[model samples]
Target: MSLEGFLAASARGGAIPWSEELRAAREFGLSAREVEAAAFGAGLLPARYSRNAGTIGLAGQAVLHASCVAVAGCGGIGGHVIEQLARLGVGTIVAVDPDVFEESNLNRQILATVENLGLPKVEAAALRARAINPAVILRPLRARLDSRNAPSLLEGADVVADGLDTISARLELAGACARLGLPFVHAGVAGWYAQASTQAPGSSSLSDIYGHGTAPAERGVEAALGNPSFTPALAASLEAAEVCKLLLGLSGTLRGRLLHLDLLAMECAEFPI
Candidate 1:
């Protein structure tokens, strides 16, 4: 069947299975992602994303598949963010992290398997994303984002997510995102507490949160307490949701505000940025 005809038929069923989508892509000489995009555009959700239909909507699914996100620091939070974005069907993910997985990362880093010790974090993220959803394209960049290379590294992304562990790198990336007019989703974790925010372009929230003048603290309390496996996933989920909301043009993103979660206390609160 023609691509349009196949999509239309799938629309009647309210979703298209991956096997059929793959067959159609092969038949039409298009990439699986391209076919999935067409399927959503034609008002059908790919079976892998079917459960997301009512919540995300068909048009939103297409939008997500067409959107690209750059995740700086694919370690603790970046690893989880990349995985969630891939499963959510975010089309292109730019996974950027200079370091590699090690024995220390097995504690909280999802992409860091014992088998992958010494593997580059970005490459590990790409591998996980593919395993989760091959239709989602992940571009792994094995480099750190300094002020000079931040823009070029994060170019073409609709939103940039901050998972960098250090304050300096986060500051540079936030500045770059602001210059590019891309919304920046940021989260910081230290011990049992984590805070997340969405900084819209032109906002100095990062500098405001981190402060002006000589770098406040090179690292947050996490440096002392260490990432204890739960905080990164908590903060990363919020960041991933923020990215998803931005890509789908949904309301209620944490723009101009910050969400603080205290896992130890089991309490969460939101504060204006």
Candidate 2:
């Protein structure tokens, strides 16, 4: 199948026929114009990218097309994180969340709406992400991350984006990714506070900075004090930016450091690992 054919099939809810493109792309390299034409036809690349389509050449296209990321939550931060990754041309995403959208989530959760109140968060997120870019392969898992499934979940992932709410799950995922040598991006939000960090293999992790697997203080405190919208958005955007940097192999990945933000105080700090 040609790249246009593959994209048309995807838009029609068919499998991504990789063999044809893989063979053709390897045998006779696709020109920048060809890639742009296919991407435009697939609705994957926007008009703005046309001017610089040659910039992300065949190698960059191959890397972006083959990379797969696992996102372990579908709440406020995770939903936005998924959106950003899709827009950035990540080819595949595994979205995991065991929770269902609730009335209370309307305040901050991006996938939460009155129509989707009873729907699973992961499912809603996948639907929205597919709507944005049908070419993206989204695997939505409606299960929580645990020791047994952690390895399988992290398998084949280039990076893991952390949006989990609980400390235990976060720690488990960090350890699992560490063992598998996959990089992980960590982000958390509660009340007027948010923090984010990237954990590369052989480097510090979320636990190293937050102490021994302690639950996010904001979760508990916010139950009594209430969560403000400012923190989640700020933290999620930073996390998304870090994910993009890592995917593009850019510098300043936030690795080995934590970015702390206090919305009420309008202050930000970076603590090294």
Model 1 misplaced regions, further than 4 Å? 9-12, 212-214
For model 2, the run of ten residues with the poorest summed lDDT? 12-21
Clashes of each: 0, 0
Model 2 Cα shift for residue 155 (angstroms) = 1.6
lDDT of 2 by residue, 31-102 (tens): 433443465545554332333356564445446666888989988788888887776667789999999998
Model 1: ten consecutive residues of lowest lDDT: 6-15
The candidate that wins on lDDT is 1
TM-score of 1: 0.95
lDDT of 2 at 65: 60
TM-score result, candidate 2: 0.78
Give candidates' CA RMSD values in order.
1.5, 7.0
